[model samples]
Target: MIGFTLLIALVGAERIAELTVARRNRSWALSRGGVEYGRGHYPGIAAAHAGLLGGALLEAWLLDRPFIPALGWPMLGLAVLAQGLRWWCIATLGRRWNTRVIIVPDLPLVARGPYRRLRHPNYVAVVAEGIALPLVHTCWITALLFTIVNLGLLRTRIRIENTALRQAADTTPASP
Candidate 1:
C-alpha cells in the first residue's frame, strides 16, 4: 500500500510537470497568433483530471483495494506505456502541443509520428492511463468513474479541436 501510494503521488507530480510544459507551449503558440477554442470547458477538464488523481488514491486506501499481482503488474506496465505515448505526442507536436486547444494560424496539419496514425493519439494515452492507473491498485471504482467522465470530456474536446483545425486550415493559404 505504501508503494502504491507513492506511485499515485508520482503520477500527480507527472501531471504537474505536464502542466508546466503545457503552460510553456501555450505561451509559445499564443505569441505566434494561436487561437484558443473551447475555453469554457477547460475548467471541467482540469477538475476531472484532478479528481481522477485524488479519487484513485482515496478509493484504493479507503476501500481496501487489493493489489492483485497479476492485474497490478500489467496495469503498471500499461500506465508506463501510456505515459510514453503521451510524451511522444508532445514531442511530435513540439510547441504546438497544449492541454488546451490552441491552434496557431497558417500552420499545416501535423502528419507525422502518432498523428500520422490517429487523429488524436494523446487522448488514446489519456484513456488508457485513466483506466490502467487505477486498476494497478484495483481501484475499479475510480477507473469506472473517471472513464465515464473522461469520455464525455473527450467528446467535447475533440469536437472543438476539429472545428478549430478546420477553420485554421481554411484560412491558411495552400502551398504551390
Candidate 2:
C-alpha cells in the first residue's frame, strides 16, 4: 500500500512537471502575441486532477483494498497506454500543447497524430486510465469517485477546447 501511494505520488509529480513545461510554453507563446481562449477553468481542472489522484490513493488505503494479481497486468497495460497517448499528445502539439488553453490566430488547427482520430484523444486515454488504474487493486472507491469527477470535468473541458479550436479556424485567413 505504501508502494502504491509512492507510485501515485511519482506519477502525479511527472504530470506536474508536464504542466510546468506547458505553462512556460504558454507564456512564451502569449508573449509573442498568441491568442488565448477559454482559460478560466485551468486551475479548476488542475485541482480536480490532483484531487482525483490523491483521492485514489487515500481510498485504496482507507478501504483496505488488497492488490489482486489477476487485474494487475491489464491495469498496467492501461496505464502504459495512457502515458503513451499523453506523450503523443505532447509531441503532436509540440510547443502549442499546454495545460492552459491557448490558441494562436491564423495558425491551422493540428490534425496530425492522435488529433487525426478523436478530437480529444488525450482525454479519452485519461478517462480510461482513471478507471482502470484504480481498479487494478479493486479500489472501487477510488475508481468510482474519480470517474464521476472526471466526467464532470471533461464535459466542460472538451467544450472549451473545441470552442478554441473553432475560433482559431474561423479567424485564420483562407489560403490562396
Which candidate leads the pack in TM-score? Answer: 1
In model 1, the runs with Cα more than 4 Å from the true position are none
TM-score of each: 0.98, 0.92
Clashes of each: 0, 0
Name the weakest run of 10 consecutive residues (lDDT summed) in model 1. Answer: 1-10
At residue 78, give the lDDT of candidate 2. 87
lDDT of 2 by residue, 1-176 (tens): 87677768777887888988888888878986787766777777777778767777877888888888788668867877888898899899888888777886677878999999878888987898888777766777777877887898888888888887887778778999
Q: List the residue pairs that clash in candidate 1.
A: none
Candidate 1 per-residue C-alpha lDDT over 33-107 given as tens digits, one digit per residue, 9 for 90 to 100: 998999999999999899888999999899999999999999999999999999999999999999999999999
lDDT of each: 0.95, 0.80
